[model samples]
Target: MTQNGFEKTGDDALDAAFAAARAARPQPSAALMAAIRADAAREAAAAPRAARPRPAPARASTRPWAGFWRALGGWPSAGTLAASLVLGIAIGGQQAVPLAGLDILAPASGPLDEAAVADLLPGIDAFLTEG
Candidate 1:
């Protein structure tokens, strides 16, 4: 047993094989080493060049409204705002011009009787009942 307490089986052929392996120091061939170095150099050369410093883009407009336009999130946001404004005006001024197809979503014509209300909220009656 060695200092690590590993017990070797007393087989002469196996012991010889292990000793041979320990004595053998395999090394890469010179040609193989050269090829590897060449590949590494080639890869380093082919690597993309450090990004070039880009010139500051030219401003398309210097008008005062340009700053306001940017603050309002550019043209896309302006389009959305215009649409919302138009929709708000249309809905707010419904009496002036009725929106088409809005009548279908209107509430039913008759008054909400007790039976109709009960049908709408079946659990409400139980909730109101005292224990």
Candidate 2:
């Protein structure tokens, strides 16, 4: 049966039940309210007063040029840094290097002539026949 809320049994019954339940709750005691207020106040006071400086924000600990020195140490396949240094000085130093300590019979320090290179190829002449 639909009516313009003249049907009291529907809305009226719900309102009355809610009102009855609301009336049954005991009022909070003043002592309990005071304790809750005291807790909130203590919490406010106990919190840290100022923001602490967070470990001075860990600045970059490495120097920018560190990798350049590491690169000079040389990579594995490229050859040892120590060996390369000696070889570079010997090769790059060229005619400037003194050869006094070397054996006297050794070939000269500079590039050889075309005729001299023909001497390196093995031939019957290299057999060292005592004739």
Candidate 3:
């Protein structure tokens, strides 16, 4: 039964057409299947028995510090940085700044010091004219 809007009509033509179409469906030929199987077999036989599987790609980290660590070559980088830090601390401790022995009151006999220019500052214009 086929219905148009609210009206219904008793019809068997639509059902028969669908049944006929379904019965006429095509299938793959035997030759096609044989060719596909032959290709698969040939490829399998040609493959090396001792062929190694490919290694999986390294997973990159999403953390901000991960890039920093990776750039330093991971554990080796960390060890180098640690060694440098330890050596720096050891050397620094051995040679300390001599703040206590600094003599600010002593004569500034060195170049560009106050004592070096003190004697020449009073007669600055006379010195300049003489030059």
Candidate 4:
């Protein structure tokens, strides 16, 4: 009996046939191998060539303000900052009273009256009397 549980009939003809089949292994013909090689060669030739890597651009060494300009978020942001700075300076330099009409720095007509001081500090009168 064989390993696959096939009983050995002891047939010489069948045993010879199996031996011949195992010995004659199928292989690709030379014509098929030549055609495959031709196809591979054609595909490789038709494929696009790989591009060479380019060197990095050289940095500007002469311009010192280039870094500062870039840090300020380019031209639009720099222009805005400059305009804001100029407007702030112009407004701060003026002596005009603000919209609140309470300029502590402005000269007064005379000494502060009781009512005026009381208005400024609501609980000041009671604290002063207790003291």
lDDT to native, each model: 0.77, 0.65, 0.71, 0.77
Looking at model 3, residue 26 earns an lDDT score of 77
Off by over 4 Å in 1: 1-48, 51-55, 96-131
lDDT of 2 by residue, 35-129 (tens): 99999999887877565335666564497775676666636634676678899899987776556845433556865654555556456355556
- Alpha-carbon shift of residue 8 in model 3 (angstroms): 30
Candidate 4 lDDT: 0.77
Candidate 4 lDDT over residue span 1-131, tens digit each: 66244444479788767666657968889999999999999988877665434566886657888888878899899889999999999999989756565654333677667777787789998899997
Once fitted onto the true fold, the runs of candidate 2 whose alpha carbons sit more than 4 angstroms away are 1-11, 23-26, 42-99, 102-110, 114-131
- Steric collisions counted per model: 0, 0, 0, 0
What's the lDDT of the predicted structure labeled candidate 1? 0.77
Pairs of residues clashing in candidate 4? none
Q: What would the per-residue lDDT of candidate 1 be over residues 1-131, giving only the tens digit for each residue?
A: 54235345588787667666656968889999999999999988887765545676895797989889889999899999999999999998877766786654444686556665687689878878855
TM-score of each model, paired residue for residue: 0.33, 0.31, 0.44, 0.38
The regions of model 3 sitting more than 4 angstroms off are: 1-36, 47-55, 95-113, 116-131
Candidate with better TM-score, 1 vs 4: 4
